[model samples]
Target: MTRHPTEHPQFYLTAPAACPYLEGKQERKVFTHLIGKHAPTLNDVLTHGGFRRSQNIAYRPACEDCRACVSVRVCVAEFKWTKSLKRQWKLGQDILGARLPTSPSSEQYDLFKSYLATRHENGGMTDMSVLDYAMMIEDTHVDTMVLEYRSKGPDSFITGIGQGPLLGVALTDQLCDGLSMVYSFYDPDFDGIGLGTYMILDHIVRAQKLGLPYVYLGYWVDGSPKMTYKVRFKPQEHLGPDGWAKVD
Candidate 1:
């Protein structure tokens, strides 16, 4: 059934489960479905309010006693390329990323499997089958796209597409004010090349070119080494009680 764009959506909370970022603690989330004609607008609003999209649901951490997860977004207009970031950018100069419609391909699934095996073997998504991966990419109502990165080929300048094996992929959403990075993974063999950071930097540039002012980086949890990288982007804003405030 279709709902009005201004209609208040019902929110549900998930039961507490083992916290992925913090060991020995539990985490819960408040989520709502993104569907119908208003899904895109609703996604924009929820994203600005600190929620992140996964599949057709928008959610945020609602842990009882922990507030470690802070939503962050890069202030793209004010972002400066540091020397280190410049080096990383040069390292990935041969790679070209293209934004494609939210569709699944066997090649993407193969890369996803390899990424999970090498980087997150013991994580929750390690056992995901091809069907599950397809659903993750296709079961979306908002303006979602997959940014596929590959080595620039001979025809890249003409066709705007690379012609080699996929090196990285980012599931992203385009909102009214920014580009939200839902999830991203890269080839583990290219770990030292910093493909993950390269993707974020690329997104910031993409956002700036589109006249967008932000690039949402999802939740950056304190004390989580894995999540620490999210803070590397300077002049970022963190969602707080007073809404998005500059993080120094």
Candidate 2:
């Protein structure tokens, strides 16, 4: 049975929890399930309205007293590579990223565990098990892909695929106007390679090739060092009460 895109979804609000980005603040989220035949279209519409996808759910910040988590999207047509970004891009030249079906693998889960232990040991995802990681990758109802970055192999030039160890992974959603990056993690040992930044740059290039206008970067908090990186991409638009407004 086909579901109509015009059908309204039932939204729910999450209980207040400690804010991850801001200290001493509580955070809440208003979310709805993304499922059925209209999932892709609904995901696109909700994303345009500042919602982000996670597994089978679409959510946006609904904090009581704070609006720090602002949705940001890179203007692909206007993005320019700075010297630092160019260097970062070059640094990852030995890495090959390929978009694959959202299938869970023990290899990817191992990498995820290592990344959380090294980078986000104290975060909410620290306790995630292999099953949990699998759910994160496979529970999506909308159009999704897992981009796996690995060290380039000898046959990479001919096959156009990476080999050996996984360097990074990005769980992304395909939207009508852009690619929404759901979550990304990298091998902490390659921190100097700036895998995270390189992934974003690659996404922008991919978006440009596909003639997409934006690359949804989830949210950017003003004072959160963890999220400050999102702002470095120039010509980005931030969602506000007036809708998406261009940020200098």
Candidate 3:
């Protein structure tokens, strides 16, 4: 009997639900638990093929007859920083970011709770408890890391301890080709300084320094104003039926 390589993935499809990005639409997802020894390698391959990791489950939109959501990745080597992007870079200069292993902490959770309460109060994760938050950070089965953003300090050791209040957090996955930004949140009070954009910009620079090719930015829905910002990162490639196509 012939066996498929993915036979061991234990895939499942989510029940149809109302689409958050598009009006009068429904959405479904094909997902699987990314655990066990092969999880890291499988996740890398899966993400390159358009899957996104959320905690331990890797999922992709599987809504019938709908193709509005497209996966995006920035070509770090080819990216050109716009004038506005440069300004954002300077704005975030006072911020120090530390990439650490996938572990949970009350300090991080406090910032996460505040961010959700302020920005995603009506979203699915709004009701998540501290336990839920811990699981979200520590349940990963792949090569994932959490980047903690804080105010820069006078010394590296002080920076490692991260002085001042937590400013932002990014859950990221390192793949063979690039880094996939699983999720990110920040202090809404810092919104005016463009922390969100600056995070992505920093990821691009991080990717370049890591000798990686791309920085996967998850999905981009064409008409969704909420997701429009993902498109502003120029020289990005959108995954389509024909394969990865560059969007100028």
Candidate 4:
């Protein structure tokens, strides 16, 4: 049976740009648009092949003379919480992630802006306006969700919603095999809770509850300090020339 044109994604290479993860290095990417009824299927396949989703686009590094970007996914069923991980988890026990729609809001944008200002002032996303942030959350064709992390309220047990100021946000994608953490941000002032690491632990538990075996954590650049946290989620698999293989 011949596949439809949309099912056979056409990829395009990006123009070289300064690498975000490495100094004095350039980066290029090969990307394909995800659309139509087959978008979810294409997302799953491309993700397993080391591609990452950004809106309707699925892309992977196509840089010349570079192989630092490695796709990582936590093995949900095999994950064992470390003492530090457990401490991080307990720190956020008063909060929970509430699944919301793809719609963006002023509150969420406020938190996003603050996070960018504090944690990534000199980074690429620092100039994103509120509209740009909205597009990032709303411009999607595949399965996606906005997980709002907030303080648990009195009626949380019944309504399953949280109250108080938003502490963090996770833009996640539910794929055929697992939840892909497309993006996440938190209030930098609210330190000591380890919100970033706590969010990943939540995703791992969520994946297990849903019977998903993996939690895609996107690319883990070998030498990038920003990516070092990814490897701590042990019992993970890294995509390679051969295929997915366990990496410690």
Candidate 5:
């Protein structure tokens, strides 16, 4: 009898497209669907192999020439914040993040629209509609969550939830050994508190409290100014041919 390996997923590659992080370059991606009961396990394995999760798909850059997209994960146990990072954390103490269900809301959609308009005007997600946003949140099969950040309420310590206008949101995945940050967006108009930096710092603290050793920060592209912030959370490992190794 002949049998096919249904447990193993098939991967497909996309046609080359303009590289978002670099000019005069093209990029392609190899991707597979994560589905069924084995999704969480599959996600963990693929993540450690330098692939990133998006909704229900796992993908990694497969450029023919450029090798600039490097996966990064912070060593949470050994993470040490610089004075600047500390300041940013302290300034944003009023904000709290709580893991909420993947249900989409009008408020979230409004903020998401504003963020895309201001921060990613010409980017791929610029045209995302509310239904698309809903799909992004609800289409996942792995162990995923939506961490919504807002002003801490009087009962925040007891409830582990926040109140007030939403400030930031991170779509994260809980892996066996770490938390993989799938994607994050924040209020671009909010000033002084460093909302972007605070969300990451909070994730590290959450990982530490949960006894997770790493906080995956997604791909870090060399020469991408936007990606430079990922390196600031020092004592991080970059995935390379030799596997994960300290780069900072």
Candidate 6:
């Protein structure tokens, strides 16, 4: 279907692919290009409707039998940290995180390579090169940002870029309603730091400060240990066939 320039973004279906979260299921996506003059506005609407952005593509699960992929957003206003989350913050207390424009850097690529090698060696994105990484961060047509986490320097204002190695990174999209976590990675060497959990905590705070009510945590697939972490943030909402419903 041809969509007018003034119309909302139009979507298309993807061919079946192996489900990344589930063991023996196939997955498909309903996607659209979020570009042109209406990208920012289109992005907001799509996100509210449970779509996720990767570069300029906005997609959501379109599986035939499984509805396991649930879009979740933390209600920043009502989010209360668990004792462990507080301790996770303390564990990563020394790491300084700064949000900057979505521009790619070699340091990011290096760390990304290391992370993929160690954690996702057999994953689909394992072979992505620096140019691919660059595109992932910089090719966006809508509002996006990169949050870099590292060890802080002595000078606050003139602090040097985090040196030695990259600790963590968050690829986030700034929507009209909230911050969508497009992707994130951390130095696997710092496994004990719980940087993944800490980053989510930080984003919740950031969302509240921005006066945004939600922080999109992407999909939470039931029975997937990798996705179970997303449910820890309380007072979150999940998108269902009926609509966004409050989850425990």
For 2-111, candidate 5 gives per-residue lDDT tens digits of 44332688999999999999989999999999988788899999999999998888999999999999999999999998999999999988888999988888888888
Q: What digit string (tens of lDDT, one per residue) describes model 2 on residues 178-230?
A: 99999999898976678889999989988999999999999999889999889
Residue-level lDDT of model 1, residues 19-48, one tens digit each, is 988899999999999988888999999999
Better of 1 and 3 by TM-score: 1
Summarize candidate 4's per-residue lDDT along 153-247 as a digit string, tens digits.
99998888889999999999999899999999998999679899999999999999999999999999999998999999989999999999998
Please list all clashing residue pairs in model 6, or write none if there are none: none
Residue 59 displacement in candidate 3 (angstroms): 0.6
lDDT for 17 in candidate 1 is: 99
lDDT tens digits by residue: candidate 6, 120-206: 887889989888999999988888889999876666347635544579899999888889999999988886678889999989888
Q: Whole-model lDDT for model 5 versus the true structure? A: 0.91
Please report how far candidate 4 places residue 29 from its true position, in Å.
0.3
| Per-model TM values vs. the true structure | 0.96, 0.96, 0.94, 0.97, 0.96, 0.94
Worst 10 residues of 3 by lDDT: 154-163
Judging by lDDT, tell me the better candidate of 3 and 4.
Answer: 4
Q: Over 4 Å off in model 3, which ranges?
A: 1-7, 157-161
lDDT of each: 0.91, 0.91, 0.88, 0.93, 0.91, 0.88
Output candidate 3 Cα RMSD: 2.4
Clashing residue pairs, backbone N/CA/C < 3 A, model 1: none
Worst lDDT run of 10 residues, candidate 1, spans 2-11
Q: Count clashing residue pairs per candidate.
A: 0, 0, 0, 0, 0, 0
Question: In lDDT terms, which candidate is top?
Answer: 4
